[model samples]
Target: MSVDTATKPHDRLAEALAEDMGRVNTMIRERMASEHAPRIPEVTAHLVEAGGKRLRPMLTLGAARMCGYDGPYHVHLAATVEFIHTATLLHDDVVDESQQRRERPTANLLWDNTSSVLVGDYLFARSFQLMTETGSIRVLRILSNAAATIAEGEVLQLTAARDLATTEETYLKIVRGKTAALFSAAMEVGGVIAGQDDARVQAMFDYGDALGIAFQMVDDILDYAGSDATGKNIGDDFRERKLTLPVIKAVAKADAEERAFWQRTIEKGKQDDGDLGTALALLDKHAAIDATRAEAVAWADRAKAALAGLPDHPIRGMLIDLADYVVARLR
Candidate 1:
């Protein structure tokens, strides 16, 4: 279907994302409803029914369509991406002890953690099965590598938390592994499955990587700046003592007194009533938030540029807009 990019006050990019999101939604529902274990259906359904923007799967679909893929396997690949994403969310909520996602109770909150964890595994296995059905070993390798990178990233982030010595290079590695790996693999597989040339496939991979980095950077920024209404709590990362880009930058720029405060709160996990405001002020004093936003915009620009060599189409325009949308929240 052709995307209409000129219909609203918002950028046409958002509209295009919405259109691709609809197709991804259908694929997620149908695939998640498999007649496997009865309990599997119920548990998996709970998380799948929880609304998400379906951005990852849409990236897969958009990349495929933009590269002139006319086959139906794109649907299966999109579903595979969503399942992987959902599984990760289930595991993440359990690990983070988070209560809310997308303004709804997390899977671990609604069901027991055991159920959430096991169902997450089931979904991962299902994702593999779906991809294998496509019979593309290259696709399988791409996704499997992504899964490994995601796990490594999560572990890296876990290790970095509360460690004052964590470097910016380590921080970027964690984000790339945790956030951008799947995105890169998803878009790369799309072009690969479509039999696109190596350069085009690599371009899609680069685009996804940059876009994912930008997306995650914005997410980290929003944990400090966004409202609870956006489903992100202020100082959420701070409360967890997780060192994100802004926090790391602020720590580097902090004076002795500010450094002591970070040691007390982040290292000791003992936050005062005014800690959130102090953290925000420190980040502001260092211009960390602005710096982080600039980094996000740079990655997003790279994502847009990666698409320059691909063939022109409405979907290509949509992909460009989608990259823009990833960092638009910061604006």
Candidate 2:
């Protein structure tokens, strides 16, 4: 099912979020339109034009507004968050050799790998520049730490690929590093810049962390269950030999023949025409999908619970709804 952008859930909260994000979008467009290096604007615009949910930057803006921040610096911070996220996507496409994102050709697919990488670096540098303008050492520290964690997470996933011995703890670490770190940092910076109390800041961080985990879990589930029309290709991760949650659980519960199947397909990356069917069967037989869904729900619940101590406001309610929406597509 498609999400309705015009009439999103939690109307008032979404409106507030949209107003905050509008300033962010304007800033991103203006910053990215620099003429110093014409290629910078051209190449960066390719990825920027590729539509995404803009969830990370939205989280940053939302957290700031919810904490009573009226300053204009939130716009710069939101744009910084988006630039960082976009830069990561460019690098990720190069690493994964992915052709499609958001139902369009990835930057790496449209341009050469060198262009993707260098432009991605430029965006990173620009993001850092924007963050420095905030003059908040704590915000800088949070984002810098997140960038490091994201790198570590990517490397960990690289090592874990096709490795049948990866444990649940290692998997959690990978998810937290690769996905949740930025989410947490985005919210943390929002709180920091807003001058929120320590407890509230921590709570927002926790909320973003849980929401990100749940969001990624649903993405994993979608890879197996969502329709191709939704832009999710089934078995793509399986074909890539990436052992996500469903595959991890399925591997653990595999019987002798099932074990051999996983060994050949996941470890060796060999598969026939019916391999996806067989994998799905194994997932069903072992109830792996159900388990993964349960984990996603648990994380979503934790995200909602994290907002309990925050002051009652429409934005807080929208954040709760956004957390639910992340996992709602799974159903």
Candidate 3:
């Protein structure tokens, strides 16, 4: 399974799904518009045009295509997925007080929290409108549940952030809620809309679930080790006092004094000038970064394995590559 180091996997997927993705993008722009609330489009466009990979929506399109769907509803479903994703991002930026997203100033930063939240709500409503147009009850159920789960996950992360006592198990629940729920739903609805068999649909769900967890873990790892090209400054998680996987692993192996250090910086939010350096040193000493990376690779492997039961399509190959690319960033 040699990857062509020349072009990235996502680029390959985009190339393969160009027409479908084009429709999804068009629908996104059309739905995000509102004549009455002009500010909605402004705020939504600011984040939507911020060079996102559109991976979640692409997952929906790829899965539908792989399952032999030739209908137009897949486009609607893909747009639904993107709208849901954008909505979550808007709410998340406000919740996290994040200043930047996708290397651009967050909507909350450019406009205000009220605009961000309202626009996020508008997107959620638009997503439901698109979902209903498909006339699939199961699709609606799955996506609505995912939206709820995302909010629940956000709440869980809000409560769990900077808590030294947060276990990996709890961390996973939060991840599943906030991130993996949408990915799984996005994939599942694709198969469901395609009238795929139960086994194949379940495989789609599993692949999306595993891929989402791996994706979030990779992001967490990048917060510690990645360059600015990642759209994040290194140690942003540390400064934000987030209890991501690497930090959680490091805490698990911490000595008493190290535990006190985490309690002060992470829990109490009293980071000194040298605390980040010390935290990085401790993470290295405990191999937390490596351990977190191993878990991400494991999840990526699970995602690839879940695809074993699916049809042998070229999109399938891109999917395997996509799963590989999820963890290859660690290299």
Best-matching candidate per TM-score: 3
Q: Taking the tens digit of each residue's C-alpha lDDT, what string does model 1 give over 82-117? A: 899889988997787652243356544656677779
lDDT by residue for model 2 (202-259), tens: 9989998998899888888888887554687788888788889998999988888999
What is the lDDT for 220 in model 1?
94
lDDT of 3 by residue, 1-331 (tens): 2657447889889999999999988998999899898888888897888878899999999999999999999999999999999998888877766523433564446567777788899999999999999999999999999999998998899889879999999999999998999999999998999999899999999999999999999999998988545667888889888899999999999999999999999998888899999999999999999999999999999999999877689999999999999898777
lDDT comparison, 1 vs 2, better candidate: 2
- In model 3, which range of ten residues has the least summed lDDT? 99-108
Model 2 worst lDDT window (10 residues): 99-108
Q: How accurate is candidate 3 locally (lDDT)?
A: 0.90
Ranking by lDDT: 3, 2, 1
Candidate 2 local Cα displacement, residue 30, angstroms: 2.0
TM-score of 3: 0.94
Stretches of candidate 2 exceeding 4 Å from the true structure: 1-7, 10-14, 98-111
- In model 1, where do residues sit more than 4 Å from their true spots? 1-27, 34-36, 98-111, 227-229
Q: After superposition, how far is residue 294 of candidate 2 from its true place, in Å?
A: 0.4
lDDT of 1: 0.84
